[model samples]
Target: MINLSIEEVLKYERGEVCNEEDCKQMTLERSQSNIFMAVVLRENNKLIGHIYFNQTVPFEFLTWEIGYIFNQRYYGNGYATEASRRVLQYGFEELKAHRIIAMCNPENASSWRLLERLLMRKEGQPIWHNANQYAILADEWQRNNE
Candidate 1:
């Protein structure tokens, strides 16, 4: 398991109350959720970003939902794409997940491109949330891999 400092958690929380106590509680809760994995990215020993995957039951579909955050300085560096690729490989090969899904704001064109490059299908029209939805099936991923 990866470890994160209280200070680092505070920074990532983005102004939320991420005190030591809260961090401990959150860490314990996260530990209990065996279906998720969180990874921290470091450069020059400095924490720069983090990503996570969680298994969810979305409607009739059982899927893995991915979410990530990066330090502002790390944007446009392709780290998101590489990290997401690694996660997808793990999800398919190791976790044996049948589906994976990701979503982003319609205005976030970069995310759309990354998803396309990974060969994930667009599915239906955007679902209203804080952002639009995109998804890929196990068959779609397998065909692309072949």
Candidate 2:
């Protein structure tokens, strides 16, 4: 996997690049906010990706939206699925979340399939970000796991 190009990684993921200061500020903001939490996905002690969860909106403590990205090289080895499953458990059990949701670019078939495989039901119409939304209730997660 490519190593150490912050601008390139940001451009690839967010369609924009940031300078070092902006990156540091963003990290600081996330760190200061108790509402957002992130977990790293690693393989053999190397970082492969990140999975993040945060309240869908401030004051909506029982609901969360999850987002993730992985290096292109690790795209099809089931790392996303494994990491997401564990994160979903953390959301429901540790965070006491009642619902967990996710969204992806409408054309991202792999992500849609991954969400479905995790048992999240597709919901609502597509939004302005051109993303399709999917969600799973805590009860649903529990029943399925049991």
Candidate 3:
């Protein structure tokens, strides 16, 4: 059990108490993989979120999944949408992915809307008690971008 103010908790979660050595080692390892990347503010270089695009099951298919999480304080500013759109573009153009998919709880309107804003097609409706799935094919992405 710990007693901490909301501000204190946010600072801790932001890595105020993190070990420099551990963070450096982690940066080295994570930097080796293009699958994950940090989203930083351009003005001050503050870490705001992370976005990843990685191969899925049966890797030969060249399918990938894109996902992201941003600081609550930074939502609705188009950061997530911009970062995620870039990630999806990388998967299609650089990774040569045949398909890129994303899933979000339909109840999360902002999240799903962001996905749609990326030009991903909704694969299914919200009727089922499951997360809404969306996807974009490489050709479709290219066509849209072109």
Candidate 4:
């Protein structure tokens, strides 16, 4: 999952976006503490999107935040959905997550709809960015998947 670009690397490093490089050394350095995955098309081997999850809380609680973005040209083909499902599976099965959460603007119908498709329920309607928070528990995921 060391496919974070140089711009994302430098932006995260120096607090700004600069370049997009595929250099492995820089990728290894950046990928150690965080998880960032680039989604690519298997038929053509082209990068179309990315999804990531991380702990951003004082207490771990085995909870993680998942987010994703895909090229507009690649939309409507289920690429984002497939990538998100894989990440959610890994979080629940491998990482033993108690819960996984996602956030998106309420205005973005497609985004929240995708979250709904993943069986996440909307829990919060924050005014900040008019964001909607969605979450799914590990038990819920397991039952649904099974």
Residue 95 displacement in candidate 4 (angstroms): 0.3
Give the alpha carbon lDDT tens digit for every residue of 1-146 in model 3: 01112233233132243355655565567668887788898999887767767889999999999877666778789999888888887778877899999877766777788888888889987675557789999989999999
Candidate 4, residue 124: lDDT: 85
Task: Write candidate 2's Cα lDDT for 1-146 as tens digits.
Answer: 22113543433245455556765566567657764444445545665666677777654658888877665667788988998998899889998899999987667777888999999988976757677889999999999999
In model 3, residue pairs whose N, Cα or C atoms come closer than 3 Å (at least 3 residues apart or on different chains), thus clashing, are none
TM per prediction: 0.67, 0.75, 0.75, 0.77
Q: Write the per-residue lDDT of candidate 1 for residues 1-146, one digit (tens) a residue.
A: 12243343334233354555765676578657864444445645554555668788663565798766555556688887888888888877787888998866666676678888788867656555546667877777778788
lDDT digits (tens) for residues 39-98 of candidate 4: 889999887766768865755689999987665667799988989999999999999999
Q: What is the C-alpha lDDT of each candidate?
A: 0.67, 0.74, 0.74, 0.77
Off by over 4 Å in 1: 1-45, 58-61, 127-130
Question: Which of the numbered candidates is closest to the native, going by highest TM-score?
Answer: 4
Q: Judge candidate 3 against the unseen true structure and give its global Cα lDDT, from 0 to 1.
A: 0.74
Candidate 2 lands at a TM-score of 0.75
Q: Which of the two, 1 or 2, has more lDDT?
A: 2
| Better candidate number, 1 or 2, judged by TM-score | 2
Best-to-worst order by TM-score is: 4, 2, 3, 1
Off by over 4 Å in 3: 1-34, 125-129
